[model samples]
Target: MAQPTVTDIRAYVLRGGGADYHDQQGTHWIDDHIATPMSRYPEYRESRRSFGLNVLGTLVVVVEASDGSTGFAVTTGGEPAAWIVERHLSRFVLGAPVTALERIWDQMYSATLFYGRKGLVLNAISGVDLALWDLLGAVRQEPVHEMIGGAVRDEQRFYATGARPDLAVRMGFLGGKLPLHHGPAEGAEGLAANLALLADMRAAAGPDAWLAYDCWMSLDTDYALRLARGAAEHGLRWIEEPLPPDDYWGYQKLRKALPPGTLLTTGEHEATRWGFRMLAEMGCADILQPDVGWCGGLSELLRITAIADAHGLLVVPHGSSVYSYHFAVTRHNSPFSEFLMMAPAADEVVPMFHPQLLDEPVPTDGRLSVSTLDKPGFGVRLDPGLPLHRPYPR
Candidate 1:
């Protein structure tokens, strides 16, 4: 059979919630009092959105093939991402073969080197790359996990990231990761509050629940060490993203300084294989958490996983919903996945990227059977009637 070639690529931007999971309204726990780099300024400390965390909405990319199959994906990067896709990246994708993911990715990356290496540009590249994978899966009539390799296990398990680890435990997750509510700038009182919350959560979750804290790049080396020591007494499993993603030296220092048995993890904001290579080779983290949507998509994630596997590190990708789920199932190094609790009070289960995707699967009892993803591509569809705006016209 002749291979299908890419005929067109389209990019659209959506406001509110979608792939931009942070773009939520009215008291979502994710934005409330979570420790962030901006926490140093008391004004932005109360809410991440206060510092424009949700300003960049969702970027939706659609790739159409000559065989009449279209595959789409959503990521964080609103109008600017759409503009990059249509004005620049689309040239690399427009005439490529459907299976030329690597070449297309390389072209996009190499061409944008002067302006793109991480952050928004990589987000745009990741969206395009993911849409290509979805397109390939549609053409092959296989799920993305199957495209990569078959699942190592029958089902995928999850640990929830939320305000209520106690509720998540009842919901059947292996454990719960709580957001670190205070940063270094908050001082001793804030540190005490953070430890108190962890103790309370541990009390509610009881012993045996794997409790962890996601600091979200908001702490200094000294504060991270102090928090790890304080949290260790409460049975903290790991401290995630304690410092900014680029602080490999700090990571190396903090990882060694952490209380024995408490793991230091980072990299939800890191991108590409080269970046992950630095994490692994430098012993910067015990686990790697790359968000497939923002970390160069599946094409780059495969390489990232290989680097992790070689270094004997676990590749627990940061939550990007199905994009993470599909990739997680196929990797032996990935024993479980992270699910972000979208429920406002963290009391119920809801789709992580609500209202944007139709048929997006949620874990039943904190587990998703591989069968839930048996449908072609990522096995999720976007609502055709969604109010998506095409910000950049080709």
Candidate 2:
């Protein structure tokens, strides 16, 4: 047998696209789209699509060898995720064993216990962990999930989010998710308007369909309670991030208060399995929404989902089904995925979805399946030599 050779662990950073920067960043008048980052350049047009904002920040890692075999992986999306990858993960992951991905994750996660753990540390690990997976797959000539454990399904269900009432119809999602924007007043009227939006989406999506919404960490406990009650009336599958991620009691309390089956979904900003375990212990959310890019990548996500399952909860990842899309399909229980409601308009600044995805099959009848990924490593790549980042200080 011939020995497999690895050349170097490479890194790249993708920031906002320049052409769409104005639309992706400058606009704040709109509700949920403001201040939030884009993931890729816009591939198509929709009514609510921002004219300016673009994909915010993502990190891609390539593991290369002498034979031209390559492994590629990316951090899930979040504001500080890039810094985590550059400052911490790159240094720790220089010479890891491709066969022991989970072991390396355990060592790195615990190594930063004194100085880092939850937020930034985990975000960095998320990116590097992904790279390790890519390397493992490419080195051994196997799909990532196949090495760890075979996938649970071929395709995963997804909901058409971020699209407008009219355009959402055409996108063909199994369900629909919308942002619950702060409304005209802080009292009953505001509550009424929020409920009205859910109603409108429900009507637009039709009675047989499912609906969900997020507070985007903007609502208070009292408001979250009111909104959850309203959501019950509309038969929502869940109400996501009803309050800030920090409010553990709020999540738990809301979970208890809401009518059965109207779920409390959160953890998009949490850092590790510890935070999610806390939520799981208290019985907070019915659906634990972990962002792979933010929570320390696949390593932590696997741990987090295990905890969610132990507590008899479901996992609904937060994204347009790129990283999480593939991951969720591998899990027998990843029930749903998210779509952005509105995004940065600029093509140059915010990275948008790949144009090929527009034609891929969406979850039409309330189900999502993983698409086939035959390419080596993590199975996705980025344009070379663009958005050059400063060399990793490590």
Candidate 3:
């Protein structure tokens, strides 16, 4: 029996240019239109715009005894997810052992503890953890799914919830998740429109498939209540980020208030399983949406899912989505995973380690196969086939 010792961890900083900076700017402008006054708080962005460098990261894990045998993983911080990784993270990663992924994750987390306890730091660790997993698989000669455990289902069923409802229906993806068309910042009208849209999507998706929608915290107590009530008949499975991520009580209320059948879930931006534990203790959500990178990578995701499992909740690891399919398949309790309706221009801009194969207008079956690693470690390769350019000065 041989166990491989981790050799070194390298942070490959990937960057690229050309994006729908204008379109993203337009979307943020809409948010700015309504949420501007709320920005009296300092947490708002520069000039209230959301367009920036879309850095995609992957952790290249190397083993002591293996050559030409290391592996990689995805850490997608779409838009600005890269700057946070390279500017602050790469230093912490160099010289670390690949096998100490979870431990190294803690060290990196501790380093970033003073400032970014949740968002950027954990997201970076996610990339590292995944890379380690890929490396572990390659070094040990196994698939990531094999190392994590085994497949829960022969094939994972996914929902392209990132799609607009009607468009998703047209694509034949019965299960679809909708984004926040409006938010609490917009007041009652926003709430009203969301509820109506939920109804329309449910009618379109019909009874058998799952139809989920994101609140993206556009809802306050009253708004969530209103939409939750109206959304009952439409057969909506779950509503995501219905309120602010910190609003645990709001989720508790929504969980109880929204008819008993409606499932509540979140955790896309939440950083660690510690946050998830709180949500679990409070009965905050019916499901947990720990993003791999944000939630401290697969290490914490497994722990968070365990907590969610104890709480009788389902775990749905949210985006940095490139890794979701494989992670979902690996987890025994992962019920579903999500994907963007259409691959982002960033995928073309920044050469992500893992290149997506399905470029259909939409996923016909709502499922995509994660690259099956025959070697050790997670085998994500950022072989970007797009016209690469310098997205930033550095």
lDDT score, candidate 1, position 94: 88
Collision count for each candidate, in order: 0, 48, 17
lDDT of 1 at 336: 94
Give a tens-digit lDDT track for model 2, residues 261-379.
78788888786888899989998888888877678777778888899888998887766345576577677668556654334321111123432122223344435444455545556
Q: Per-model C-alpha lDDT, please?
A: 0.93, 0.61, 0.58
TM-score for each prediction?
0.99, 0.80, 0.76
Best candidate, lDDT: 1
lDDT of 1 by residue, 39-119 (tens): 999999999999999999999999999999999999999999999999999999987889999899999999999999999
Over 239-315, each residue of candidate 3 has an lDDT whose tens digit, in order, gives: 77867788888778778887777788888767687898989999888778887755787777878878887878888
lDDT for model 3 comes to: 0.58
Higher-lDDT candidate among 1 and 2?
1
Cα TM-score of candidate 2 = 0.80
Best by TM-score: 1
What ranges in model 1 sit over 4 Å off? none
lDDT of 1: 0.93
Between prediction 1 and prediction 3, the one with superior TM-score is: 1
For candidate 2, the per-residue lDDT at 107 reads: 76
Q: After superposition, how far is residue 72 of candidate 2 from its true place, in Å?
A: 2.9
